[model samples]
Target: MTERAYFDELYASSPDPWDLAARAYELRKYDLTVASLPRARYRRAFEPGCSVGLLTRLLVERCDEVVASDLVAAPLVLAAERAPAATFRRGGVPDDWPPGRLDLVVLSELLYYLSAADRAATIERARESLDPGGHLVAVHWRHPFVEAACDGDTAHAEIRRDPTWRVLVEHVEPDFRLEVLERGAD
Candidate 1:
């Protein structure tokens, strides 16, 4: 897991460490993630690691209610300002999942930051939180990076290994990977 202090120090250095709002790469990636959602509208959604809320704003358009969370408080504050319609909170995954069934859960650019165990826990928690036939979307940069515990390809591979999810859509590019998974109906 990326330590909370690390995230806090990062935010202290610069308000937007990832430059999610200014870069075209980020903008285009967010567009792809939003475009790839299988459902046109969702009753409720959860977004973990919502840095600066750039994508949260777009998610608001597709979801009636969204709970966007981060480990550190500073970015979440910014996220609240950016998308007041969405609920912004400071919490980590696996432990911070909102109560009740969720129709959409977004894991964009988050898994790689977690330890392997935490990553698995987050996936498990996400699956458990989804309502029947609900969707889970994940988008991550494909390239290896120093800060990431695993590469994006490995993260997606881990998700694909689960037997309960069915792929609804997949978009792969040189820069990133995106997958939409639906909870199988019993």
Candidate 2:
């Protein structure tokens, strides 16, 4: 599990540490993410590492219900305030896997922070919880960062290697990579 202190300190310093709410890059990426979804409406969706719920707000319009979570409670507080309809929780991935199978799971700007082993475990958990024909959308920054354990290419490569998932959409930019994958109905 990621240390709470790290995220706690992050939120203590700034409300939107990654500029998730204000950055034009993030706004465009969020737009692309929501657009990439094949289905117009989903019964249920899950978004882990939902910082301030910027994407969650968009997802709420497309999903009948959404469960968004983060490792620290601070961001979730803001997220809940912003999107009261979406359930917000303070929890990490894999270990804190949510209840019920999800038709859509969004992993945006979150995977690179985990070690390789944890990252793999998180993907596996996502696969396990995904309903048949469910969607898994992953988006991450491509550049190297001292705080990040892996790059966007590396994270998406791992996701592509999973046999159970079929790539549906791939978008690449100088700054980031976004991929939409669907779990096989079988």
Candidate 3:
């Protein structure tokens, strides 16, 4: 059910489950995610499934307000300390989706953890939340793992099907797929 228990168990064993802080791969990925954003500045952004907030830290530099959330609270505690500038909360996607319009929504390495239906719901939620002409960026690992309900290609291909999304940037690599799409208006 959206990998909540897996995350909880992972966090209980280690504060940083994937070792996101120390990985050069993650650093490069995060940099690419920031670089891919079409706008230099955003009014408000939502970063769901933000584990440890490394990306959220960088996002705060470009966004006026950032809401970073995770299903597991243990990581949010650390994420708050790591990125005090952004607001950190304990929440999940779809069901716990936040209220209010958004200028940007980041679904980073998070979609694969959910079942196909929830993944679509998460994307739809972003579509509904976006202020017209807002941006939605999704980054996911390309390879399949035991925890993933689907591969990056499957999830990203679904995003491409949305009628309102206009592709701004599509960066594909062996390791990951990153897409920055604008909602409404070509």
lDDT of 2 at 108: 96
Measured against the true structure, the TM-scores of the candidates, in listed sequence, are 0.97, 0.96, 0.97
lDDT per residue (tens digit) for residues 48-160 in model 1: 99989999999999999999999988888889999999998788987887888899999999999999999999998888889879999998899999889999989989988
- CA lDDT of each prediction against the hidden true structure: 0.91, 0.90, 0.91
Ranking by lDDT: 3, 1, 2
Clashes of 2: 0
The residue pairs in collision within model 3 are none
Question: How should the candidates be ordered by TM-score, best one leading?
Answer: 1, 3, 2
Ranking 2 against 3 by lDDT, winner:
3
lDDT of 3 by residue, 28-68 (tens): 99999999998999999999999998999999999999998
Better of 1 and 2 by lDDT: 1
TM-score of 3: 0.97
Error of 1 at 14 (Å): 0.7
Give residue 104's lDDT in candidate 1 (0 to 100): 93
lDDT of 2: 0.90
Q: Candidate 3: list runs displaced more than 4 Å.
A: none
**Model 1 CA deviation exceeding 4 Å by range:** none
